[model samples]
Target: MTHFGIICPPVTGHLNPMIALGYELKQRGHSVSLLGWEQHREMVEATGIHFVPILSPRQAPQPDQKITSSRRMRLRHKLHRLKQRLQPVDHQAYTQSNGISALRIALAAYQHWSAIALRAAPAVIKAKGIDVLLVSETSYGGSTVAEYMGIPFITICVGIPRHQSSAVPPYMTSWPYQLALWARIRNRLTYAWLDILQRRILRLLNRYRRDWNLVPYTTLTDSASPLASLACLPKAFDFPVSLPHNFYFTGPYINDICRKPVTFPFDQLSDKPLIYASTGTLSNQASVYRCIAAACDGLDIQLVISLGGKGRDVALSNLPGNPLVVDYAPQIELLKRASLVITHAGLNTILESLAQGVPMVAIPGVLDQPGAAARLERSGAGKFIALKQLNAKRLRKLIQEVLQDPTYKDQARQAQAVIQQSGGVKHAAAIIEDVLDLAHISV
Candidate 1:
């Protein structure tokens, strides 16, 4: 049996897919283990995979600050504010500060997590006789372990493809697939800056690699399963562009097999068309929740809002038609009954919605969310409203349009077909076996 070690960031979106992949590999008689943060240990262990802890560097605001949903600026939010602070100074000043600052923060976080992973991993690899390593796109340290140990590794990318390409807009920017001349030039420049940031990250990575006598990597992407880059998302979500030779679009890696079913009150709802809304694990603005409640106020829609992160005691008093407010919901189950979803355009949520043929109204905030939202709009599967422009009236209108129009649902089904054909973890497991076969690595 081939022993596989999977490394990932602690976030739910990243960990969930990796957990699913581990189950699939284990089902095939391969041993699977996961290395990540301590908080996720219970969840990982619940999957019956060996769990290794990666020490997380305490950021200024703490990790929980990031998960807290409020209007007050958290530490990371302060960094964003600092980024915007440079905007009025000068173009170059804003670009340099904003780009480098964000890159440094990410590098710092990755460096801490990776350093811990690198130190703890070799021993585990040796003990387990691990044949292959599966690394999350966010876990920079996993690549270093592969480099140090000379093991075959496959990158599991769950979200927007971070690799720079002229055909696609640089990640984090909400630019659509179709672009004009100026837009194209802007896109190129975005990639250029992105490369600069990646190079900065590479420098830090190489510093750690030096201790192991491994060669320095020129491109950050090189560290990501160079032999076989695996994208857990389907090609349908990405732009029409050529990918690298080793890149494999392995489709949505939903953890359906091991997914713990969440129970929701089925008897506590009206007969009105159900609308499911979530702002994701991080940053569920109470204001947005209130807006949604007001929008659907007295309307013929029963709104189900998932206020993610730390759930406070919420009284549904004075809300429109007594909307259901829960800390979390059985999202897959909700989408099954939902006619429309209001989301932050997280990759997993978008894919889940597509799989269920549920249309969306994307409300993206920060990171790759904007790009995901743009993809939804471009594909005609959903519409996006900027956070700055969100209100009860506009949101209500969009919801009304989505419910009334059949085109959105039709398009969602088309994407669903793509998702199904791409195959889930089963296909990924097959491809991994193929990679092992090509390498002549004995099981």
Candidate 2:
């Protein structure tokens, strides 16, 4: 049996899918362990997979103490500033400023996390005698650690696939997929700009590579595993762009059997058509929630808002609609009954909505969300509005449009058909095993 080491960001969106995949592999008789932050130990171990703490006690955030590190404090300040700047005022200016600020903040966080992982992960993997590694595409240090140890690893795209191509727009933008020459040129130029902006991250990675006596990665894609690169996105939901031969779209690694149980007030659900609204687990902005509540206030449908564990302190009673507000909702279960989903266009939520054949109106925030929303729109499954363009009146109009239109549901059902056949966690496990077998044969 292969002993697998799983590495991903500590955030819920990334961790959930990787853990689900790990759980599936363990069920198939392979041992699996997650190397992550100390705070995530309980959440990771709950899935019956072993958890390895990668950060020293000095570096890990303490539950009761405030983090006073200069880097962390600066990050918190940047986030606070970002939240303030996300107000729906000037659409064009907001988009530009937000993109730059968000990119800076993301790069800073990546550099910090990668530094810790590169320092600590090698020893843990060696100590555990891991046979194979499953690294998230977003976790910059996982593949580096595997290479330094001379082990095989597989790349898991927990979000949108980050494989670069001039034919496809960058993951951060809401640009549509167009095969025209001009469109390709625009995509290439954007990628070039991004490469320049990300020089610092590349330099940081190469510094470690040099010290480890490994070849430096000139591009981010060089870090992806040649054996296999797997994505949780369904093939049907993505743009018609060609990817590397090693890449496989294995649908979403959704293993509800291993997920943390959330206590939702199911009895409070009414007979009215359900509208599930969420900004995902990471984005718990009260302003966004307020706008959503205001838009659905007078509608006939019953609105259910999930604060994603970050909104417990939000005054639910003060929200415009008397919507059922929960810190966490049983999302997969709720989507089954939902007629419409208003979301931040997170891939997991979008895939879950499509799996249940529920249409959506997307208000994409940051990271790969805009790209996912673009694909959702291209697939004829949903409509999307830029977060900066979101307001009560506009969002309500789009919500009504999606709900009244039959085509959206029809398209969603078509996508649902593809998801049902994509083999999800099972397919992912089988692929990993196949890759492992092939690697062994080559050796």
Best by TM-score: 2
Q: Model 2, range 251-322, lDDT digits (tens) per residue?
A: 988878767899998999999999999886223367778899999989999999998876545555688978
Question: For candidate 1, lDDT tens digit of each residue in 24-91?
Answer: 88889888888666778878888788886644222222222212344233423543443342222131
Worst 10 residues of 2 by lDDT: 86-95
Worst 10 residues of 1 by lDDT: 57-66
Q: All candidates' lDDT scores? A: 0.74, 0.82
Cα RMSD to the true fold for all candidates: 8.9, 7.1
Assess every candidate by TM-score.
0.85, 0.89
Backbone clashes in candidate 1 total 0
Candidate 1 ranges with C-alpha deviation above 4 Å: 55-108, 196-200, 281-284, 313-318
